[model samples]
Target: MEAVILAGIARRVLDELLRNPYRTIELRSARNVMAVEAALREAMRLFLTYDPFEDVSTGTEGLLAELMEAKYLETRIPWEESDEREVTICRAKVKLVGLGRVVEVERRKGVMLARVRELFPHEMDIG
Candidate 1:
């Protein structure tokens, strides 16, 4: 039996093209090759349900690998010891994890850049 699927239908049609003389064939038949056209309609219904973009809206192939593993270099403060505020610098690039997307939030002081996700390896040099 050969099953050929037609257009716009999820079901298939079976046809017996060959006849056997020495063997008795009732419900059991053999098919060489069959084409599935209507099966696409049903398969598409399942694919569209769960897509890769459910979490991430966009994903670019290459983005310079901006974030990397690094260590906090130092903290720079402008005020005096009594009421001093500190700034932070990392040794190398920082690692970004669990971030669906990467986008530059803002830049400060021309040299200071902040990212959307928090820096990993939590314990970093702080002043």
Candidate 2:
């Protein structure tokens, strides 16, 4: 159950980081486990808002289980900041839950930098 919550938080954080407009994001609390748990709670709150019909009584365990079975479970964490101090490398430690194996997916700084440009190509071109 804790894994499920952590996975959800990682997914949400990664998603937000990917979409972040800043060229460099400074996450001072990235290493704190309690901060991570707080992020999980916030993500869960956001999820509940999207689907008001979902039963709150069933809790995150059931909801996360459903997401896992549907193949929608993926997570990412800020693994390291670049030596050059230019980019942050986010890693997906748990690619899939309930698969009986741990799959790692590292999103390098170069890739994420390219992704940000891809997201707003016109803006980059204008500058």
Candidate 3:
């Protein structure tokens, strides 16, 4: 089923995000970016991944709505005023589960990117 595939992709993204928390990654292509976004949406509802990053990554509740409204603003600067245009990475924010944090995601050159900015240590009982 499509839902199953989406859920799986979402879990993978969450795992990768926690695996290297706070790090911004530039995915291979736009398709990859869309995959991540779609997965986030699906994960918001059914968080099936709960490993590595610990308990906080429990696929939090109501994260989908936040991500849906999250601002997607960007500035573009073309390398040349021609058909071939190159611009800076596009940026946006999305509330992610597990860390219970809003991450900054970027897209450029048909690639996807995101940075897990903050993760409350208290949520993980770090202190």
Candidate 2 residues 24-118, lDDT tens each? 22222233223223334433111111111222222222111111111112344445654443333332221221111112212232110000101
Clashing pairs in 3: 56-98, 57-98
Q: Rate the local accuracy (lDDT) of all candidates.
A: 0.20, 0.23, 0.33
TM for candidate 1 is 0.19
Candidate achieving the largest lDDT: 3
Counting clashing residue pairs in each candidate, in order, gives 4, 0, 2
TM-score of each: 0.19, 0.18, 0.28
Cα RMSD to native, each candidate? 31.6, 17.7, 12.1
Better of 1 and 2 by lDDT: 2
Order of candidates by TM-score, top first? 3, 1, 2
Best by TM-score: 3
Please rank every candidate by lDDT, starting with the best: 3, 2, 1
Candidate 2, poorest ten consecutive residues by summed lDDT: 110-119
Give lDDT tens digits, candidate 1, residues 12-97.
11111111112111111111001111112222110000111222122211111122223433455766773646544423221212
Give me the runs in candidate 1 sitting further than 4 Å from their true place: 1-62, 66-69, 79-84, 93-127
